[model samples]
Target: MRIKTVQAWWVQIPIEESRQHVSDFGRLRTFDAAILRIETEDGVVGWGEGKNAAGSAGQYAALVHLLNHEFGPRLIGRDASQITAIWEDLYNGSRASAAAARGHALPELARRGLTVAAISAIDIALWDIRGKALDQPVWALLGGRSAPRLPAYASGGWADSAGIGAQLQSYVEAGGFRAVKMRVGSMDDRPQVSAQRVRAARKALGPDVELMVDAHGTYTVAEAKRFAALVEDCDLAWFEEPVTADDHRGLAEFRAATMIPIATGESECSRFDFASLISHRAADILQPDPAFCGGITEAMRIAALASSFNLRLAPHLWAGAPCFFAGLHVLAAAPSGYIVEFSLGANPMIHSLSRVPVTVQDGMIAVPDAPGLGLDMDTDVIARYARQ
Candidate 1:
């Protein structure tokens, strides 16, 4: 089928609880997502979501604009099944624009940051359309089902204004999450303070539960090492983005200093960047978010690269329902070491974006059997949160 129309929405749903979540990026009080809907000539519609540039102002608007004006126009008349060719065209188009501007060459990550997110959403939507046309699940399209249910980890435990420990305890008790990840490195300059927060979360979680910490790339090599040293006693599952993702050498240094497995790559957009991370031995676990890493197509490439290196793939998901489903497919296709990250907090977009909210049962999420991400968007929810 041929592409007919592409639509994008810049949505911001208010967090119901309005809790102050302190992280390396600062406080997060709303769920901002860029949702994309692609329509085929045959009347098939598929949905996708771009990662919300949390702290960057106007990033969401830029994503919507890029999708509507640039990417959408290019995809309008193309064969929907030519996903690989379309992805190359998009990547080359972005690179050509950079080359025409000046002799200055923006790094792959920097160049992709400008348009890859828009490309990601469009690519995912196209895949969804393809799956619907073929009447096959995305996971099956990727490769036959690898597991019955993928293990999920609760992704909350943010340093809430009320109490980090209490927030974690409540999520575990209510969600039945076997594993949890908490925010760390909020006090960038103070490793001791960050370590204290990690200790508190471990204490609340006790010894039976698995605990992980995400620094969100807020620390220097020295700071990450110091914090890791302090929290080593807690037996962390992994240290996520302890230092800036860009600092591969620094990340390697941090990894060498701590026995805790290093996890990075949420900001990475392509397989090339992930290859660099593996070559540099920067991380043991690779967390590529489909919304940020050039959609499901590129995520598969990154997953293959990770598997070759025996590195684990745990998709980084913190967006709306579309992203969550996209991540789920990737996790389902990934090897045994993979796990899904489910947001534990209350975000109206996550709970309401689709007619049937994605849920975790007994700390595991079953793969959706329906075609094309197996989700039906709730237009009412989109109308309620669409930017006016």
Candidate 2:
């Protein structure tokens, strides 16, 4: 069947004040998600999430436009199973402009985020089509060598002292999540204060639970070191984004100073960006967002790079709809074992947008057994929440 139409949706998932608290960088706030849907001639459809963040609605809308007006037109009628060829066309085609723009260069982030998200949706759609064509699950088509069930981690977003205890305990009780991540670095001035928060969180989770800290790239090299050393005995799994993502030299220095392993690259959009971190030995683990990068194809390449250096590939996921599935496929396919960040604060829109809500059981997610990307988009929910 020929490809017919590609649609992209950008939605706002409302987070109430009770949900927001000081964490990692600033006060926890409502997050907006950029989601996509691709439809083909014979009624096959696939969905994806873009790398949209707290206040990036406009950028996500622009991405929807790019996919519909520019990118979508080119892919129509092309074999949906030709995922690799389609990916190369989009990535290589953007070479000149990608080189011209750099990291978080507002213009660059927009260009890269939109372009990457669109390509990702297409890649995911292609995988879905491939599964349907082969009458097998996407995981099988992706090469199923590992066990079907995937491990997950309880990723905390709330920051206040009053809120942290209940949220941490609930995940342990219900999710059976052995590893958990918490936010730190709410105040930039008091490095010691940050350390105290880390220590407190560690104590609350207990020594048996594997704890991880996310600074959200808010600390300076010196502050990161001071904070890490204070809780060096806390047994943190890793310190994530303590310094800004772009500062490779600073990251290398921080890695040298602290015994804690450094984890980052959630903001990164390509493998080339990861090259710097790997080359500098700046981080012990790499957290790539498939929605932010070029998609499953590029994520595989990034995972391979991380594997070469013997680093862990724990994806940074805190968005809506398609983000989890896209990350799931890559993590499942990755040679090195991986764990995904599961939010205690579940997005309400998740069930509405997905054909199947993820099969999360006791903190472990089971891979989808259906063909294509294994999940379908419930467009009815999309129509209900469509931004007016």
Candidate 3:
């Protein structure tokens, strides 16, 4: 079972509705979903999706060319199961370029957000290939603790006090959900004002909701602290990305000052990037996105590092067709850290992309027992929605 060919494609599915948060608007997400078709001499082929949500179609396209033209040529006869060596080859050999890109090819830079996204897609595809070769789920291959299911949280994007409140209520009433997170930091930076909104949400959702707030890294240390202190009584699950990703020290300061746990890492790239955050004890929770943080391989490594510090691992997911399953595989194997982020809005790409529509029952996602991430793509849907 050697990798015969690695192919990548750019897919564009029109998001029926614009995804609006505090400071950003996702009207048209142009992402590159890498379909790595690893073929065996015996004629068995497996598919994988490496999708970048930061719109890295172009960068991912470049990576796809490199993989198929350069790396694929070298790996044609090599065992597809050698994922670690291949990942190391891509990492160390690609390090100079990766450093030059400075996550520009990844997602740390605004202009090259798509490039990082592309890397994410390809990386995910590689994992799928590795899993298929071993006849195991990506999580088990990655040495994740086995669990039949994992807890989840409702990630409401850009809902106001009223709109968000209703969304939370619906999730709780539906069962399967133990926690919920709301997007915050849309308005002014007054801590008290944000507190009032949280208070209102709490009143509407009641006390046991395990409320959490995401500032989208739109606040400063002072403002984050202000909001954190006020919401201490709100029974927050965690405070996510209160300050910008650049402000690791600011996050450290904010965490030190607040009683609420500080959660971040979605914006971070590789394990090296997260190592600094862990060493500094900057955040109490880690939210690594498989799409943004390389892929399952890197995410598993990040989760392990977080476990050493007794930190929580909750992946940050927006709405990508393949990313949900990709994320689920990693979370499934993860020990103790099981909650995954979910979108409240209707996303056709996620529902229609899979061979099986991903279902969430009682706020917990069931792990698919099938091979290679347990997902199959609908090419017709891809053809209809594929970016022209």
> Best candidate, lDDT-wise?
1
Q: Give the per-residue lDDT of model 3 (tens digit) for 1-388.
A: 6666666555655444354233333333443354555676655465555544443323345546654676557667767666655555455454535644564323233322344444465567667766766678777766754678777787763555556677678877765577887767745346676777787788888876788888878888888887877878888878888999888887888888878888898788777778888877798888888866767777888888888888878887764666778888878877737587876655565676787867678777887676677777787876775543
lDDT of 1 at 283: 90
Error of 1 at 165 (Å): 3.0
Model 2 segments beyond 4 Å from truth? 20-31, 54-59, 94-111, 187-189
Residue 305: error of model 1 in Å? 0.5
Tell me the spans in candidate 1 whose CA falls farther than 4 Å from its real position.
Answer: 55-58, 94-110, 160-162
Inter-residue clash pairs, candidate 2: 128-372, 128-373
lDDT of 2 by residue, 38-58 (tens): 667887776766654532233
Candidate 1 backbone collisions, by pair: none
Q: All candidates' lDDT scores?
A: 0.81, 0.72, 0.68
Model number with the top TM-score: 1
TM-score per model over all chains: 0.92, 0.89, 0.84
lDDT of 1 by residue, 1-388 (tens): 8999999998887764455454555566777889999998999998988874752223488789888897889888789888876776677675745644664433444447847888789888888998999999898998877887888899876664247788888777766888998877754458787777778888787999999888889888988887888888999999999988889998988888889999898988788789899899899999888888989998988989888998999988877788888888888886633888887766566678878868888888888889988888898889887896
